[model samples]
Target: MGDCTAQCLHRRAPTEGGAIVEDFTIIHDEGILEVLWRPGIGIGPGELDVLANTITHFPRWHASPVLVHLNLVRHITPPARKMLVAYHHAGPIGLTGSDPVDRVLAAFIAQSRSRTRYFTESAEARAWLSLIGVTAGRPVPAPAR
Candidate 1:
């Protein structure tokens, strides 16, 4: 809603550890926030805080769809899992990528109030998000290595 569009004009400056952590990149367009995470970095309190902050950044975020690209991530720290249990309040979340750890993590977090779906392709994720009224912006590009 701010400066972001299909091209993702709104960019957060790289910070140490936040929602857009060193191991991940975040893109926003319309109301959807696409999180592209690198494998092996363990998510923890700092990362969780960053996610909360990002989601609350714009008023639309709470109601928006979040597409998490966890194709690369291999691990989720215990603390991070706990934090997810306590803080993952978003709904209509779409998760993609073939990482087994990511699948497990998504299932664990979606146990109660979270509405989550998994996909092997990003296009399907976006389609689902669009169906849910979350703006389906351009296809999310892969984060630069």
Candidate 2:
């Protein structure tokens, strides 16, 4: 299959009166999905729900690996953490973050899933995902652009 790339930004009002707005971007490249979470955003159940819906709507959601950027995330609510543990993605997941809190949160999620790993650098995470994809019988092609 030829290379395909798509990027979308999602915004949602976290509370009434349009006070707080949380946004995230999802980039689909090759056979992987990269989720870029906005800085200082508090991740709650609503945010996770939006993420779930966005992934479900992707064309290759079931088979595509995911690279999650969590370096800037402020915190994750308890409910959101629980939801993430239960969330199921068919392919491997690579989480990249540098902050201690980010690593801790990622560790929690990664520990609950066999195909998930945390990385301090995004390049490493992508490399891991590529390796996982190849070993899983799905060779991830390099980006065309």
Candidate 3:
């Protein structure tokens, strides 16, 4: 991996009695933003809103490919799913998940975008993102072996 820095946006969960929690971690490496979500957490419109805001304010975000890890998500509300499908990123997006439900969800989101793909492995997803970045003139570095 290229020189990278990671940031965690500890946004409050809507159902956690107003406790501040880390809903997701965003890693910036080369020209990629890798988002790792909390396992077994339920995602709703509130969570998606926070995510959208965080990404929108991130530095150079418009030029970075995104890799979202969706494995082990307990559930995603219907409204959240709709928001995700409509969320726009200037660069390509790569979604990685293992469960069957994850695959189905990824397929649904990918179908709505020309620059999205689903992968069972994160490494594969990262590779795809790097390729897309290169083709798009972002030039993300390949992961080190």
- Candidate that scores best on lDDT: 2
Model 3 misplaced stretches (Cα beyond 4 Å): 1-8, 12-19, 137-145
For residues 1-145, could you state the per-residue lDDT of candidate 1 as single tens digits? 3433454323243555545524555677655778766556566667667767655665567767888877677677778777766654444788887767667877766663667788989999988887775333435557899
* Local accuracy of candidate 2 as per-residue lDDT tens digits, 57-139: 67778768899988888999988888888876778999999878988999778755548999998889998888786667456
By TM-score, who's the top model here?
A: 2
In angstroms, the error of model 3 at 25 is 1.2
Clashes of 3: 0
Model 3: per-residue Cα lDDT over 1-145, one tens digit each: 2233555344445444866566776777666888878878888988777787887666778868999888867788888878777866667899989889998878767755448988888889888888887787556569899
Per-prediction count of colliding residue pairs?
A: 3, 0, 0
C-alpha RMSD between model 1 and the true structure: 9.9
**By TM-score: ranked, best first:** 2, 3, 1
Report the Cα lDDT for residue 49, model 2: 79
Where model 1 places Cα greater than 4 Å from the true spot, the runs are 1-21, 88-90, 134-145
* TM-score per model over all chains: 0.69, 0.80, 0.79
TM-score of 3: 0.79
Which 10 successive residues of model 1 have the least lDDT summed? 2-11
Per-model root-mean-square deviation over C-alphas: 9.9, 6.7, 5.8
The candidates, ranked best first by lDDT, are: 2, 3, 1
